[model samples]
Target: MGRILAIDYGTKRTGIAVTDELQIIASGLATVPTAELMDFLKDYTQKEKVERIVVGEPKRHSNEASESEKYIQVFLKALEKQLPDIPVERVDERFTSKMAFQTMIDSGLKKKQRRNKALIDEISATIILQSYLSRG
Candidate 1:
């Protein structure tokens, strides 16, 4: 089976995570600049047999789409155009960031490391992917 990729799309940075061929576990892959996300995915798809793409959908407490939804929509459009054959899905990411922060605190990470947004992004992506996996 091919791997499944998950993206935590943001305006500044995009976090990436991937599942194993068996789709059992999700691991943080990378955090890249949003501007380079498409190219990065293109390269990743060439190197890895990615069968599906899942993007984190931002929403407010009221279940309304957040402002970031606009950007994510654009990103989805681009992704669909680029990878026409692959399916791109969106999973709710309401508290992934907060959960990731709590995880860092629970893990006893240093303040400096916890402050690293890139690290948080990666962890959030991992959480998002894991949530998706759990649903299935």
Candidate 2:
């Protein structure tokens, strides 16, 4: 079986995660600049067999789409246009960033290390992928 990839899209940078070939474990992959995201994905997918993609759907606690959803929507459209074969799925991304921060603390990362926004983004993507995996 192929791997399942996940994305945590942001205006500046994007987080990426991927599961193993058996789709059992999720791990942080990379944090790429938003402008380079499509190129990175294209190259990665070409090198590896991706069965599906899970994108974090930003939403507010009130059940409304967050302001950032507009950006993500645009990315989604481009993703669909660029990669027409793999299916895409969405998972609620509420609290993911917060959860990632807490996870960093719980894991005993130093203050300086935890301040890495790119690392947090990568962890957030892993969390999104793990949530999807657990749902099934």
Candidate 3:
């Protein structure tokens, strides 16, 4: 079986995560510049068999799409065009950022490491993937 991948999209950068071939565990893969996302995915998919993609759907507590969804929608259109067969799923990403921060603190990361936005993005992607996995 192929892996399940997750993307946490941002305006400037995107965080990526992937499950193992067994689809048993989720792990942060990378933080790539938003402009390079398609290239990176194209290259990676050439090497790894991705069965599906899960994108973090940013939403406010009031159930409105966040401002970032504009960029995500554009990306999703490109993704659908590029990876036609692969299904794309969305998961609510309401508290992922806060949860990632708390996870960093709970894991005892140093202040400097905790301040890294890229790390936070990566963790947030992992969180998004984990939430999806938990549904099963």
Best by TM-score: 2
Could you give candidate 3's per-residue lDDT for residues 56-113 as a string of tens digits? Answer: 9999889999999998999999999988888999999999999999999999999999
What is candidate 3's CA lDDT for residue 7? 93
Model 2 per-residue lDDT tens digits across residues 1-136: 9999999999999999999999999999999999999999999999999999999999988999999999999999999999999999999989999999999999999999999999999999999999999999
Per-model TM values vs. the true structure: 0.98, 0.99, 0.98
Please tell me which model should have the higher lDDT, number 2 or number 3. Answer: 2
Could you tell me which residue pairs clash in candidate 2? Answer: none
TM-score of 1: 0.98
Candidate 2: list runs displaced more than 4 Å.
none
Best by lDDT: 2
- TM-score between candidate 2 and the true structure: 0.99
* Per-residue lDDT of 16 in model 2: 97
Candidate 3: segments with Cα more than 4 A from true spot:
none
Clashes of each: 0, 0, 0
lDDT of each: 0.94, 0.97, 0.94
